[model samples]
Target: MQAEAQLAKSAILEVALQLAEKSSWDRIHLFDVAREMGVGLADIHRHFRNKDALAEAWFDLADAALLRLAQTPGWQQVPQKQRLQFAYSAWLDALAGHRRLTREMIGYRLQPEHVHLQVRGVLRISDTVQWIREVAMLPAAGWRREGAETVLTTIFLAVFARWLVDESPGTRKTQVLLGRLLVAADLGARLVAGLSLRSPASLRAFN
Candidate 1:
């Protein structure tokens, strides 16, 4: 029974992906997914409440793949910035085969009129950043943690935007952009650390 349920869920998601590849997300309804999978509407509803939920599940699938890659040996020893690079690289690699669909979905969600989707996108980025922080074994809470999340989220969106249109082989352009951003981030961190060292009381007050 459990396996059958899982299969039904997977079929729904697979059908949704196929539909998304051919049509705009806004036009692709749960009914369409159900029909494509030859399942009852209730079956899809049993797995995903709505299109957004299904999309979030797809993101979760990608995140799971990224997390697995992050767990490989030697990943833990890398510097935080390098770890982030790896995470973002893995994420893009996972989506490479579905680049067109990804681009369409991202573009649709980010449209000015889609405020809800924009908010969801921010939340999703926040979640991804938190995951990256955990894999990097960073401190749980503090100004540094909050700052890292904000910075990493911004970097991910910026790099991801470049990645969508990037045509260079191996996504070399996106990689270069990420490398530069990381260097800038490192320098900024060093400057902040230096200032904190010079004014411990101020740092404490800010914290």
Candidate 2:
């Protein structure tokens, strides 16, 4: 009895995702989810306010996955770039099974008429990037912290854009792109900090 009661939001999310896989987010109704779960509509409401909340709940799964990485063995000992890649890959892999459905959910909410949802999307990106930073243990401060967040957000979006259509084994193609982007961002940041790319003798030859 306790186990069944615990299903609540998580169970509702699973059923909705399964239904969505066969059909779509638009076609699935609260009553359908209740019927599928053999519970009443009120039971579903006890967990989720509406169908859209289920999509948010789905993303929460990825967030939870990313957080778990912090507790992984040697997580804190790893270099920043490697930790970033592992953390980001874990977040994406959580949605790998439902990539198409996840994309559809975003599209449904991104309609021009749904300005509120679009705004929420921006917040979601910010929150995810912040979470990734925390998990990777980046210790940047003030302007440096802000700059790091901006670069991380840009890298995340670029990697995510590639990941959406990536069909490579274990998403190796996306990982390759992610590694290249991180290196490029590092080099760009170094150059901006006035670090010379050429050796001192090379500069002397140009002089």
Candidate 3:
């Protein structure tokens, strides 16, 4: 009985994944997933309460895979810039591998307060950002902190957008551009802050 229950549960999730690949998440329905799974709708409900629950589970899988990648033995040994590149690259690879399904899943915004369902995905992204900062030797306390975080997130989204359509080789150009932009912005902000500290009167001198 337990084995049969587990099989039904797996079928429900599998059908949902297939539906996502074929269409948008908004179009996915529990009834349809059950139909595709060759099981009754009641069987699916026994496993997943609703479409939202399944969406959360799908993202949870993606989040777990990302955390695993981060824990690989050689991952930390890479340079900070390379680390950022790898993080983006892995996301691109995952999206590419599950392009149809991910396209739908990525569109849903999990509520910030929904800690129970969103915790793993939220922590994965947060930790990755923090890891990048630490490896770059970036100071946590500074005027640049906000700006750096903004830029990093922007670069990440931009890379994903490009990967969605880019046919270029290994996204080499895109990766290089993103890396240069981030490094330049970080260094430039730090330099400006340093100068401001040392030459506060320079502004008046210029005026």
Top-scoring candidate (TM-score): 2
Global local distance difference test of model 3 = 0.60
Kindly report the root-mean-square deviation of model 1 from the true structure over all alpha carbons. Answer: 4.5
Q: Runs in model 2 with CA error above 4 Å?
A: 1-6, 195-207
lDDT at position 99, candidate 3 = 57
Q: At residue 146, give the lDDT of candidate 1.
A: 76
What does candidate 1's lDDT look like per residue over 76-187, in tens digits? 5675667767777877887787677778777778779989988988878888877866665554357766776777777888999899999999999999998898877766
Q: What's the lDDT of the predicted structure labeled candidate 2?
A: 0.82
Candidate 3 backbone clash number: 0
Stretches off by above 4 angstroms in model 1 are 1-4, 111-113, 139-141, 195-207
- Clash tally, candidates in order: 0, 0, 0
Give stretches of model 3 more than 4 Å off: 1-11, 22-26, 40-43, 105-144, 169-177, 192-207
Candidate ranking (lDDT, best to worst): 2, 1, 3
What lDDT does the true structure give each of the candidates?
Answer: 0.75, 0.82, 0.60
- Per-residue lDDT for 29 in model 3? 86
Per-candidate TM vs. native?
A: 0.83, 0.88, 0.61
